[model samples]
Target: MAEPAVRYFFGQDGTKLAYRDLGVGRPLVLLHGFFSSGAHQWLHSGFAHTLAADGHRVIVPDLRAHGDSAAPHGAEHYPDDVLTDDAFALIDYLKLTTYNLGGYSLGARTVVRMLVRGAAPSRVIVAGQGLREVTGKGGTVARYLRHVFSHLGTFKPGTAEWKAEQWLTRTGGDPEALLHVLDSVLDTPADALTGIEVPMLVVVGDRDDRDGSALALSRTVSQGTHVVVPGDHTTAITAPELAETARTFLRDQ
Candidate 1:
């Protein structure tokens, strides 16, 4: 397997973004979760290697403000579903008319956004997330963003907010810009997710009921499949079964 190499591309607004390219076959784009970049969430977890070894050319982008990408700390840099737009830009840059795309957590939410925006990836995998995030009011995301941006270092250790701070700090992400992204994604209409024609695999941890059922979400789409893996939200992302599930779906005979 070829080692992943760092590459650069420009977003719609000219913000330079970074991505890792590996292997040599079908292009598989993997988006990482909130506060986590492509390197830690996908590469470090061995998920990227798994896909690459399965006869795929893996493309993992470090979303703006989350990795080696330019982290602009302003609202203007983040429009509604802008992260998805960035992904689309990468796809366009690669000139790939069809490819496989997937993500976990925030990246999972992004898959839904891409579907709504009419991206026609040949296959999609949404892991570690559930229905509410894709179709609910999204109040919790806004509240969490507000808490992080407002309080910053004030959150005590051992709490979720404090842990969140650490994750953002690892990539030198700007909290204000993240809040803008939250605002942009929250504006997406809940009803837009239902009749998507794209074939999707919604894989969530069986115990991750906090965000509603992944099965329920998949059933709404015309060509969706649901897979229940072990563990909760966080643990599910690193589960070996996730890579296996993805390999099976993307390589079906």
Candidate 2:
């Protein structure tokens, strides 16, 4: 059977954030990685459709500045808490007291922040992010500028350029907002992960850059499980093993 797509929008500090909903029954939100929209990460993944097939409703949104969502022009607009609030707003807008959550890479980072802030879900699945030191390189401002120039005249929406654009957009394409988010990522408090009690499954590819960190994070969480699939960062998304692993985890939950 062909899956149906539902369009919806929820307010994020007064601005509308767009989302695509599919399937029915229990709600499961899927967050995409740093340089990709929810469509590319979840819908294109076959993961979204698969979950829908199994009687799970999926909510996929392009974070604040990515995809077809609103892109405000300020640093204050994209802070970690603010971004996390957007996710919560969507949940409340849907009137769901609780649901399942999953994300990859940057999306995974947000899920961790959500968990820290007490946005507890029935179960959580994080891909690409594990445990790693939040190193201090330069401030968020410097990183944001670097991102903008790095992708100048380079990335478009739906090709190899897509990844580049994804990173550039998150950095805000504006210097101030870029710096703000970078700083937020670097300066995030350590206590955030000290006591995550929700059940979690952290999946990483054997060759993924964050493999070691993912394992470390798995160990840190009180109830976390780690799975390793074949291939590197990008390939892991399409790898059969990853799909199977995700299916098993979500089904079991």
Candidate 3:
């Protein structure tokens, strides 16, 4: 099927947000990672299609400052837990009383924040993140992104930072707005994991350890399962197994 047309909604702060709705069945909201849009992360990778095919009404949003969403350059536009707030706004706009939620990397982190703050999605898929990242203890991913943005032109060819910068350029990320989005990242307390009463799945690549241990993060959730797929943080999202694993988890009840 052709990709669903992008839709618009006003956020709690009145900023226009962009999202795509597809398939029909249980509502499933998937958030993309930082510096990426729902189209680039989900549509391009064919991930949303697989899940939608499996009896889900997939809703993927371009988080504020990413994709077709409104990207305000001023720092004042972003408040603490802004992404989390945006997710809640989308849910409210869709009038989804029951649904499944999932995301990757920065998006995955946002999913954890939503749960700790009391989002009751029937099932959840947190990929490419670990406990330390959620608890604000893992600064590796944030630090790396900051380094790339802060020293934009300084990275040498073939270096990791340069590679990231190249990817950011390809994604058409707004550097100024994304920096502010970074400042809004919320760190959930380890103790808050107890409050998540629904089934949660933590999927991490076998070679990925950027945000620490995915297994450890899964163990913290009362009803969590950890799945190890192939590839690292960057490559993992494109892995076919990633989509299959998520589809299976979401279908298992």
Candidate 4:
């Protein structure tokens, strides 16, 4: 199917954000990962199509500083929990009272924050993220990204930081904007996970643990289940089974 047309809305701070709406059924908002856009994470990987085809009005937003969203170089635009704020702003702009929400990687982290801050989605999908990712101090990925950005063009070819830089360059990411976004990240305390009463699906790849324990995260939630697919941190997002498993989980009553 053809990709949906991009739509625009103003965030709480007046930053213009973009999202794609497709299919037609129960509302399902899916957020993309860091250093990736909605089109790359969802559309190109066939994840959104699978969910949309399974009777969902798939809504994927490109977070601020990623994809088509405004990438302000100023630090003032990236307040603490800024991504969470943007997510809530989008939900409010759409006027969605009841909806299923899910996200991958950074997106998943944002979903957890939204829940902690009082988002009442009917169901939630947290994929490619783990407990430490949600609760750990100064996130591993955040630190790693900081290092990569801080030393861009100085790393050896085989180093992980170099690889990350190459990926960022290929994706046309804005280092300054992304660094500010990373700086705005606020860790969610472990105790806050218990307050999320809605059913939650913790989907992670068997070989992926860059952030932390996925099973541990699932166990923390009041009503959560775990599903391990085949792939690592990066490849997991493209795994076809990931989408299929998510569909089954979200479809269950």
Candidate 5:
């Protein structure tokens, strides 16, 4: 399939976000993982191309702090609610009342949160995420900090070497921002999951480092279907098998 041209838009808070519009079926919105842009996760992964080829209108966006989006100055600026609001804003901006939603890792967490908050889509796909693990002790902020510090010197800001840093900085990488996002994720109300009425697909890689947690989360959704594909977390999004499985699920829905 030909690469779909990407378009840009502003979220409610005025942060610039970019996404790709592909194919011609039901709208399928794809949210990418933290620190990774939509292009890197969806476009580069070949997932977007495949979905477009399968006739699904794919909408892949760079979340507020990542990719072509404008990075604001504080972590608090990227709170879960704000992120959810961004999704809604995007949908409204596109004049889409209902569509399908999916994401990987942090992106998946965002999808679940949006669902909990009543950001209803036609169907939802939670890929490469296990909320059970995320809601545990550390939450996204602590885990991200660990990943950042551990991988320190491995990436630089600005150029490709600093992609993660660029994202972090864009979202206002101060201590306050970290605490805000952490608290939001850890304290997400339980009633949120129980209220969702749409079909849900929980996907994870069999060989994922986070498999145990992902499985635990899949069990939480009231009307969820689980699929274990081959490969690790990153590969799960890029692998042809996983992409095809997602396409099938969306089509069946």
Candidate 6:
């Protein structure tokens, strides 16, 4: 098959968003994790390719402030639920009434927000995340965000912010914008994770202490399924088991 083509669309706030399109079937939109983009979490990790070849049109977008998407560093640009709006905009732009949706880490947080907002997707995949993080217990993730914000609009070597900036440089990202993205959605109600009727999968690694326990998160939702794969938060994104598990669940549906 030919390489997928990149497409651009404007968010509700007029920020330019980027996505990659592939295959032909029901649309499955996947969002990437923090400090990562569609290319990093899905394409490079082979998750997007797997879904597309599985007979689904995989649409993976770089959330605002990440990847090729336009990044506006100010808080005004990242109002609460901005990411959620962007997700819905993509779905609406494609005129997809029913589709699959999912995200990893920060992306999973967006999925939770979308779900609570009543965004309807046939199925949802929550990867490399746990209830604790969604419930506002993101100790480590919070620290990283704090570090980034502390040095926003400037650079200090050997810090988390510095490392993230370096990575952004490599990816052509907007570090200030990404930091604002983190600050924007740092708090979500714990009750939001419960009572989701849509088929949902919560995936995390056995060794991942980043977000507490994934199994507990699954139990809270009526239709949630938990899959414990090997590796930590970072490794789970690329872990083959993660893809296979999600693919199986999606296929079963």
TM-score of each model, paired residue for residue? 0.92, 0.81, 0.96, 0.97, 0.81, 0.91
lDDT of each: 0.82, 0.72, 0.90, 0.91, 0.73, 0.82
Clashing pairs in 4: none
- lDDT by residue (6-106, candidate 2, tens digit) is 45566566766778898887899888875467877788878788878778888998776666666667666765556577778888888887589998876
Please give the distance, in angstroms, between residue 190's alpha carbon in candidate 5 and its true position after superposition.
3.7
| Residue-level lDDT tens digits of model 4 in 1-253 | 8989999998888999999999999999998999999999999999999999999999999999999999999899999999999999998999999899999989999999999999999999999888878897527677778989988999999888888999999999999999999888888999989888999999998888643478888899999898999899888988999999989988896
lDDT (10s digit) by residue, model 1, range 71-156:
78777888877889999999999898868889998888887888888888888898876676766544676587678878998998
**Better model by TM-score: candidate 1 vs candidate 2:** 1
Per-residue alpha-carbon lDDT of candidate 6 for residues 112-201, written as tens digits (9 for 90 to 100): 888888888889999877787777775676676667656655776886577776776677766567767776785566676666889888
User: Which residue pairs does candidate 6 place in steric collision?
Assistant: none
Error of 3 at 167 (Å): 1.4
What lDDT would candidate 3 get against the real structure? 0.90
Model 5, runs deviating above 4 Å? 74-76, 134-141, 144-187
lDDT of 6: 0.82
Clashing pairs in 1: none
Backbone clashes per model, in order? Answer: 0, 4, 0, 0, 10, 0
The local distance difference test score of model 5 is 0.73
lDDT of 3 by residue, 1-253 (tens): 6989999998888999999999999999999998989998898889999988889999999999999999998777899999999999999998999999999988999999999888999999999998888888888778888878999989899999999899888888888899999999989888988778889999998888753478888888899899988898878888999999999899898
lDDT for 248 in candidate 4 is 93
Q: Which stretches of candidate 3 lie over 4 Å from their true place?
A: 210-212
Candidate 6: where are CA atoms >4 Å away? 152-165
